[model samples]
Target: MSARRQRWEIRPPAPADVRERLGLPPLLATLLYQRGLLDPAAASAFLAADYATGLHDPFHMRGMAEAAARIAAAIDRGELMAVYGDFDVDGVTAVALLTQAIGAMGGRIRPYIPHRAREGYGLNNVAIGQLAADGVRLLITVDCGISNYAEVVEANRLGIDVIVTDHHHPPAELPPALAVVNPKQPDCAYPFKGLVGVGIAFKLIQALARYGKRPANLRGRDMLDLVALGTVADMGPLLDENRVLVRAGLIALNETARPGVRALMAAAGLAPGLIDSGAIAFALAPRLNAAGRLADARRAYELLLAGDRETADGLAAELNATNRERQALTRQLQARAEELVAQSGRAEQPLIVLASPEFNAGVIGLVAARIAETYHRPVVVIEQGGETSRGSARSIPGFSIIDIFDQCADLFVRYGGHAAAAGFTIATAQIPALEQRLLTLSRQYLRDDQLAPRLMIDAVLPLTELSWELYAGIQQLEPFGQGNPQPILMAPNVTAIDPQPTSDGAHLRMRVRAGNSVFEAIGFHFGRLAEALQRYPTIDLAYQLAVDEWNGQRRMRLLVRDFRRAGGARNGG
Candidate 1:
């Protein structure tokens, strides 16, 4: 965690007229207004979260017709089809969802997830050749393939038609596949252009179901569990259509009778019915991604599609062990990267770029992400390969890290990613040049203020004002992620009582009181605050209000984000 004291950015209060105009509670209206929901009708629609009203017709997406027709033709002909996905959770869930959906329609479809260390990202000709040899007449890529032009051509040469269904940014020239179904394509006008890979794959399933009555009655809603898992795990925006999908998906996830989901929840220490997007992002996603990072992603894909409880439990335990291994390795690599940064005297630079043989290519992205979060700057961490090196980049909120590659497009062998994260391959000899070029670019593009991280508080609400009713209203903003965030409420002059490190010695647990209202607060990773709280008993708090459910009892709790001595300086990380 970053030790730097985050500069607080509190939103200005909402207009008083917003309450009467929207006909909602004061706090709910304020939260909605703060999120730019001013119109009465729009606010109602947003709060309703009605799936039918919110989700667009799948055919509304540009390539839906073509993609759906091609897949339908394959199924009608009884051709062997495969869903080729990336190694991450987003790709794994996508492969599972599409495979199951097609199989339910009497199509023999299997999943193929690339190994992060071996076959690498996107499509490889060798894997495509292997799939072709397995009698696969059709290949549909989920979460990837927008950038695999040559691989798609190779599939075509092997007499297999390819359909590219991805959400990543498309190239100037798309693959000559049978169909392309990415929402980010230049000509695509998907109202919500932010569907992650599985979200796009879900839309393809919806489109295929619309082809006929039998497909329509395939119980597609049962698959929302996969959609929610993938979307939140991949950091997709939680607004517009995505909000509706995820809200319903959470219901599906909670009520899922699938042995795989049940076992995974148990493995993650989550109550079956109490899971949320946060649990998915923090606990479930990492464990699922661990298989890809440390071993074969097929383990996770198989886990999601497992039929029996024993099979599911075995895979879930494997993923749990792999996650533990991944965590230990991440801690080790993070220390080394930080040590390298301290030694390089490059901590003050706008962009931190480092390359070493010790940095494993599979986990460099995690290291870069942690570095970027700690320093609030763009970061590039590369693994020194024999001749060509692979690098992963993480950016601050407003900056597009991929732009660093776009500006230096001529130097890389291959590159693709989103605004905040990207990956590239370049000649090892060109690393110094890449660093200097990145330095030159970051100076022109980044400002000093942007380098200092800001903690954004949604609104200021004293503890006395929080209530069970208000918490229920907040539920309307379900499945919060990238675009929509959980409300962070600020309460000033909070008195800290009995503040101390938790039993595990990894967090801070304390009782907080504001006026007559009191709440139990827990600060994960803020265990060091015990000393500061002992000195300054009175402090201000930035926190998210949550319900702690235990033994069938529930009570309001404060999940502390940060705190500082009242009228004094904030605690440094």
Candidate 2:
């Protein structure tokens, strides 16, 4: 099947004043302007994000002082504490980081990452009861517990003072924990609200080191690798403090001392010191997340805390194996999901929903994301459990999945997430009603022109503009994800030369030419259009610049984002 199409939006020219003041190439100046970094000083600061000066005071975050003090006192009193977290990469990294920080602070801490299959998400009352019985006097949550009101109350009743730290949007009725340190709390004054699960945990560690007994071994920067992993994996917007943290965290990740990190990198066929946010998101994070989706998340946490190379290597192998299994299962399930879409004749609907008893609860979110991308529509993949079911949703721009969930809140037993992604549990009998409500809401919010996804083009340039200097200028914006995306340059009416499918027939390797400038281009997922060389005499291409190193020789290459026949741009701004 042909992939979903996108509406291109090419940015207008940068202001002469701003461009002149910045003293950069036109392309560079425009890229900065597009990202809301117009001021030369601010643009300079962003490009050169530093650790010491870039970080905000954790105390500025509401409830941080109390949360830090309480945690410090627990350490001083040698209390048995449990760090409860979710099951995904962000949650596992947070738990591992906190566990290490507490241990280094002379505190007895136990890491608790809930099983994804058995316990859906968040801090469950059953887990709290078990921790209380395990002599846990203090409970600290990371990446979870903001919405876990009953669980926190149960912990409080059991004599376990609970401190909740999460990035998820808070409910109207907040948890009655002793202290809640979350940036998304309505009244919290934390400058950066984009901190992911592990980023918040890193901030807690910073507060502890500053206010409490500063341990010699527990430096906050040392644990930034975990922050980078979780932040990128969780798709946290890479802007402001998040950019700064990930910039420094990438350094820590490149020089990571953890045996498990090294082993994981090796398992992913990556070099030790070459990791960046892109690598974390695509290469490393999935392996860690696979453990949680398939088996226990604690394995991922344990891998991070591994002390020996042997153990780390073994765990990395197991995670890689699990990831392979996850890939095979996802491919199988995605085929079924596509069939469902065709059978329903709602492939063009505002929202696409696929439900089945055979759907694996662990991989529904992955399937939903893929389907949403392929159909250019909001997707909800449900795993029917006879009477009740779990559904994971992924949405395109201008549509909020969580907002739809809130509108249909009465139908869901529980639901929580941000705009782009969400999850819920609903009685299987109510699936029809939920679908109808979602479709209605989606139609009301989305227009016919807005059905397709938009591709934001950073700049329009000829192939002659591609140079080593321009590539270097682009590389300054390191650690790209979410808000801070890699730049996409477009070449109008370029000729496609020698386009051919790759070995797997999923992508295309080609050459593109504009005037006398010709460069190699690789179009991922463009294999279906294998007649690329002959189909179009000329094409307009949107792409990012990449370096292709072959036989130890480096040359500029084009990582094609999309292409179309000349002058075929769909509503470009």
TM-score of each: 0.96, 0.97
Question: Highest lDDT among the candidates is held by which one?
Answer: 2
Output the worst ten-in-a-row residue range by lDDT, candidate 1. 564-573
Q: Cα deviation of 398 in candidate 1 (Å)?
A: 0.9
Clashes in model 1: which pairs?
Answer: 3-573
Local error of candidate 1 at residue 328 (angstroms): 0.9
Pick the TM-score winner: 2
Q: Which stretches of candidate 1 lie over 4 Å from their true place?
A: 1-3, 213-218, 568-573
The reply for model 2, stretches above 4 Å from the true place, is: 1-4, 550-552, 569-573
Model 1 lDDT tens row, 327-411: 9898888899999999998899999998999998878999999999888899999998889899999999889887667888777
* Shift in Å, residue 52, candidate 1: 2.1
